[model samples]
Target: MQGEEQWFSRTPGVEARQKIELDMVNSLLTSVAFASDPSRQLALEIIAEQFEQPATIRTHPTPRAQLIEIVRTYARNPDGLRVLVDVVASFDPQSFGTVRLRQLFDEWQAAPSFTDDDWSAFRSALGDVVLPQLTELFHLATRNRRHRPPAHCKTAWHYFVHLTDLNAGADSVPPYMIFLERVAPLLPSSTGQELRMRNHRLASELGLITAVNEIHLHERESLPPQHHTAYLVIQLESDGIDPERYTLSHWYQWDADGWHPERGEDRTVSILEIENEVERLVFDMETNWVEAVETVTLEFILPWELINAPVDWWRKESHSSRPTPLTMDYPVVVRSLERLRTHRWHRAWHVRWQRLNTDPTSVLPYWSKPAGKNYHTLLETDLKSDLRYACLVLSEPPLPDSSGRTEIETALRAGLPVIIWHRRDCGSPDFREAVQQMLAGETLAQLPILARKLRGEALRLDLADRESHIGRHLTMLWDDPERQPEVSRSYGTPEEGIR
Candidate 1:
C-alpha cells in the first residue's frame, strides 16, 4: 500500500487515484478487528470512497459492510456522516447510482440528532454535484420508458417544487407554474404530455381540479435545448411564501408517510354549514343589491386578536407588534379587502366572522355597550346587507355559530361561496381521505408504522388543509354567471387578477 502511494506520487489521474485510494482502504480495513470500534475512522473513509465508485468496478460486500457498520456505529455524529455523504455524492456515476446513494443518505438524514449544519452541508453537496448527475441519469433511465424524448428532460414545474423546498421554507408554491408560463412555447410535445400527466395526478390527489387546468407543458417550447436537460430546478424565495404559515409542509409530510384522517364527518358538516351561511347571506345581499341598485363584495374576518386585546391599549399595543408578520391583522385585513372590493354598480360585503375566547364578559361588554356600539352595529348591518359573496374563514377550534340553520339555508339560497380555512387538527374527513390515498403508495406501505405514525400529525398540528380554499373560491367565481363576464373581460387583458 505504501509503495502504491509512493508510485502514485509521481503521477495522478482517475486510474492512479483509484489504485492509491483502494490500497489505502484495504490496509485500513485490515487493521479494524471489530466493526463497532470508534477508532475505525480510517476504515470508514476507505469504505466511503469505495462506495462512491461505479458499482461494476468497486469491491462488493466487504467494503459495503464496512460502510454500513460505520453508519450503524457512529450514526449519532451527523457531521461525520455528512462529510462521508458529501464525498460519496461527489463521485461520478455510470447509471442510477445516485438513487442508491440517496437511499443511504436519507437514512442518515432521519437521525434525530441531525443538526441544521448537517442539513445545510447535505443540500450544498446535492446541488453542487449530485443533482446535475441525477438529471442526466434520469434522462437515460427513463428514455425508453417514454416513447419519445421529452421536449426537455427537465420537468420545469416539478423541478420548481423541489427548488422551492430547498431554498425557501419547504412548503412554498413551487415555481413550476411560473416557469411553465414562461417556457411553455419552448417545450416539446412529449414533455407537454408528461407535464400534463403529472399535474393531473397532483390535482387529483389534492382535489384542486376546479381551480384551473394544469398548464400545458408544450405550450411554450417547441424544441427544448439538449444542454438544458438538467432535471432539477433550484428556487429560493425571500418573500414568496412561508411553509409553516401556508400549511403546505404539513400536508406533504403526511402524504410522504401514512396516516388516516380523524374528523371526517364533522369537518364535512362544518364546511357544509359554513357554505350554507355564505350562500344565504349572499342571496339576501343580492336581492337587496338588485333592489337598491348597488354592488357588494364579501369579506371574511377573524377577530381573535381584537377580542383579546387589553382594555388599556398602552399595555397591549407593545406586545401586539411582536407576533409573526404573516399573522393576519383581522380588522386591518378585512378593511383592506373591503377597499379592494369596493366599486360601482353593485356593492355587497360580508365578513367570515371569528371571535376570541377571552373573558366573554370583557369582550362582550365592549361589543354590546354604547361606547363601542359602532362595532356591533356595523357587524349587524353588514350581516343583513345584500351581498354578492359571503365567506367564513373558520379556524380549527370553531366557536359556536349562533346563526343556526337559518343562516346556512339563507347562504345556500343566495348562491355565495363559503370559504373555510380550517386547521388540519379539526379532523376533516376530506383531509383523512387524501392522506390515506397518499399513504397507499407501495413504498410508503413498506415503512415501519412508527416511522409513519407522524403522517397525520402535521394536520393535527394545524399545518395543512386538505381542501384548497383559494382554488375552491376561484372555482366558485368561475362558475358564477355574474363573475364569468368579468372573468372573460379580464382573461386576455392586461388587468389580470393576482395569481
Candidate 2:
C-alpha cells in the first residue's frame, strides 16, 4: 500500500487491449430474454478489463482459476485491491473477495502492525466506505485481545483519533458518540470522557441542552439502506390542556458536511424558535437521542454558531433555513442593587413602574430578561417576544421578595440601572429629593400644604382640562416678573394662605 506510489507512476503495456462501450456492455447484461452463452463469456472478460492492467488475461483451464489469477494479480496494488473488492461486493455480498477483505480487517484489528506513512494510501484505498464502516471498526476495537494501550494498535489508534476529529465541532450529530457509548466500558476512563465531551459540546449547541421528559424512537419499517431514516417520538415541556403531546418526527443524515436536515424529512426548526416556542411544532426533535437536555433559553446556541465561525446563526438568524434575524424586544432596564434587599425593592418598583408606564416604548425597553425567567410567561412565545410589566403598590417596609432582590442584584452586575422611586410611607423622601429645587430658588416643593392643595385641584379637573390647571399652578408657584409680588399673590389664594 505504501510503495504503490512508485509503480502507479509508470505506464504498463496495452498491446492486446480491445475498445469496449460500457453502454453496450450494460445492454448485454440487461437483455435477459436474449441471454446466451457468448454474452456470459463477454461479461466475465469485461469484468477482467476493470483489473487487468497489462491487457493479458492468463489462460486457465478453469474459469474459477482464471478469476483467482486476476485477484492474485490485483492484490499486489492496494488501489486495485480496494476497487476490485468493491466490484466483487456489487456482484455478490458473500463473494470470496469480500470475505477475504473482512478477514484482513479482522486480522488487523485483532493485532495490528505499525508502519511508516501512517497508512495514508490504505486509508485512501478505503475511501468513503471507511465512514459507514466506522461502527463496525469501533466494535472490532472493543475486542482487544492484546494487553496494551489502544494507541499501540493501528485500528484503535487511527479510529480513536478519527472518531474524535469527526465529532469535534460538527454541527450535525455524528455517529461517533454512538460508537463511543457502545465501547465506553472497554476504553480508558480519560479517553472515554474526552470523546463524550466532544460529542456533548456539539449536542448542547442545537438547543438539545434540555432535560428529556420522555422520548420514543421506534423504527416502523426498514427502508432502503441509502435512505438511512429513523422516527423519533419526543415529549418536550408542553403547556396545554391535554397530557398527550406529540412532536414531529426528526430524520437526520450525517455526511462529510455537518448534520443536514433531510429536506422534507427534517422539519426546519430554529434555535430561536425552540427557546421561545418550546411547546411549538418546530423544536429540537433530536432531544430523543442527544444527551443532557436542559431548559431551553434564547441564549442557548447551535453548533454552527460556536466560536470562530464564519457566521453565527445563534446570534443573527432564526435557523439555517430561515435567515431572518431574531429581533428581540426592547430591554427592561433595572438598577444595580448594593444590598440583597434591593432586588426585592427593585422588583416592587418594577411592578409599579411598568403598570404606570403602560405605553409600549417604556414597557418594552432596549434590553430584557432571558427566555426562561420569573418574568417570561410566554413559554411558547417567539424568542423575539417579551414579557409585560407588573406593578407593586406597597405602603411600607418589606418592599419586594427574595427573587426580586436577586433580580436587582443581577441587573446591577450586568451594568443596567434600575430606577427606584422610593417615597417613604410618611411621604418624607417625596420632598427630600426636591432640595435641589430649593437650591435653585424653586423653594416651594417643601411646602406640603401648597403641594396638596395644588394636587387636589388638578385631580378635580377633567383629563382634557388638566393642562390649563397645570399652567395656572405653574403661574402661582413663582410670581410673574412683569407684575408686582402683591398683585400675583392676590390673584392666587390657596385656602386663604397658599394655592
Candidate 3:
C-alpha cells in the first residue's frame, strides 16, 4: 500500500496530469515516429544518465514493458542502431553523463510532466534491448580487430555497471561479472581459439594463449595466412585495417615479452625447441598413435600484463616471432589439432561436466584432440547400463559440473572401470580419489587414475619414444586384468601415482 501511495504521489497535478496528452503506453512508437534526432537522442541520453541512480524498490511498477516496447519501436532498424549497446555502454560510470540529462529524467519522474511514465518505461526498455545485444557486440569486439577504437571494453564495463545499477533492485549485483561467467562456459573450443588470437581476458583464463612461440595457427584449409608463424606481427592504431608495419617492428612482441633483454631472448629461444618436440609428436601420433610421440610440455608464456598496460603497447605488439635457438616444450596446437582429426582413439562415452563452464585445460592436455562431447546433450536413450567402455573423469578443481559426479557413480555401479590419465598436476580431488582407490584394492575398477604427467613424466620422457612411453601405456591398458593379475607395464605402480 505504501508503495502504491508513493506511486500515486507521482501523479502531481490532477489537472496538469489530465492535460498531459501523450500516453506512456504508446510514447515510444510516437517518439520514434515523430521526434527529431535531438528529441530522440534526449530520451536515450536521459535514460543513460538515470542509470547512475542507486536502486530502490519501485512504488508503482515502472512501465517497464511499455517503455521497452517504445525502444523497440524506435530501434526497428537495429543495424542503424547497432551502436545502441555501444551508446549505452558509453556512459561515464563516475556520475552518469551530464547534469542536464539526469535532471530532466529526475524532474519528469517526480511530477505531472508530459513524460512522467516515459523515463522509467524507457529505462526498462533500454535494458531489454541492450543486455542481450551486448553479448553479440562483445563477441564481435573480441574477434574483430577493427572494433578496437570505440567498443573499448573499458567503456563497456562502465556502461554495463551503471546500467545494472539503474535497473537492479536494492540487492542486485552488476551484470558484467555475470556476463563474463556466461561467456567463459559458453565458448566452444573454436571460439576460444579465436579469442586467444585477440588476447582476450577470458582466453587467458581458459589458457588459450601461452608464453611460448608467438606462432599463430588459425590457418584453416580454406583461410589464407592470418597466422604469424615466424614473427609476432605489430599493428599500430594509425595503421588501421590490414595492420600497419614499420621496420622489424614485427619483432616488437619479443621486446614486449622481455626479450629486449638478451637474457629474455635466450630463454624464449629455448622454449622454441619444445615446439619441435610437439611437431614430432603430431607426426608420430597421426601416422599411428601406437608409434606416436607425445609432449611432456607444450609451454605457452603468458604476456598478460604487458599487453594491457596501454593501448600504445597493444598497438605496437601484435605478433611475436616463433622461437629462435628453440629447445623442447613449446606447444604446437595447430599441428596437433590437424593430426588429431584423423586419430583412431575413442573418446569417453556419455561425458558429463560437473561445472557450468567446460575447462578445456584438462581436456586438451589429456587428449591429443579435445573432449568435444558434452554430457548435457545426451538423452536417456543414449545412456545404457553394463557398457564395456572406460569412463574418464575430469574433476574440476573447485567443483565438478553438476552431473559429473553422478555419471561417474553410475558407471561404477554398472561394473565399469573408470580409467583416468593421471599426472603431476592431479586435481584438488586427487587426494580423496587416491584414498578411495586404496580402499577399493587392486581391482581394475579401483585403479588410481593414470595421468601421463605423474612425477613430471612428460617433462622427463620424450613422448616420441614409442616402446618405452606409448607402448607401455597401450600394453597396460589393453592387457586383461583377470588373465594378468598384475600388469607389468603399469610403469610406476598405479598406486605410486596416486600420491
Per-model TM values vs. the true structure: 0.20, 0.21, 0.21
lDDT score for residue 498 of model 3? 15
- Sorting all predicted structures by TM-score, with the top scorer first, yields 2, 3, 1
Q: Write the per-residue lDDT of candidate 2 for residues 293-370, one digit (tens) a residue.
A: 222112111111111111101122345573422112101111111211123333434443343334423332222223
Best by lDDT: 2
Worst 10 residues of 3 by lDDT: 331-340
**lDDT score for residue 339 of model 1:** 19
Q: Candidate 1 — number of clashing residue pairs? A: 33
Q: Worst 10-residue stretch by lDDT in candidate 2?
A: 13-22
lDDT of 3 at 162: 28
Q: For each candidate, what is the lDDT? A: 0.28, 0.30, 0.27
lDDT of 2 at 351: 42
How do the residues 146-253 of candidate 1 rate in per-residue lDDT, one tens digit apiece? Answer: 212222123332233232222111222223332323332334556444444444454456554333243343233232223211010001111124221210000000
lDDT of 3 at 259: 20
lDDT pick, better of 2 and 3: 2
Q: Write model 3 residue lDDT over 4-96, tens digit each, in one string.
A: 222221235333222221222233333332134455455455444534441222222244443443333323332312233323323432222
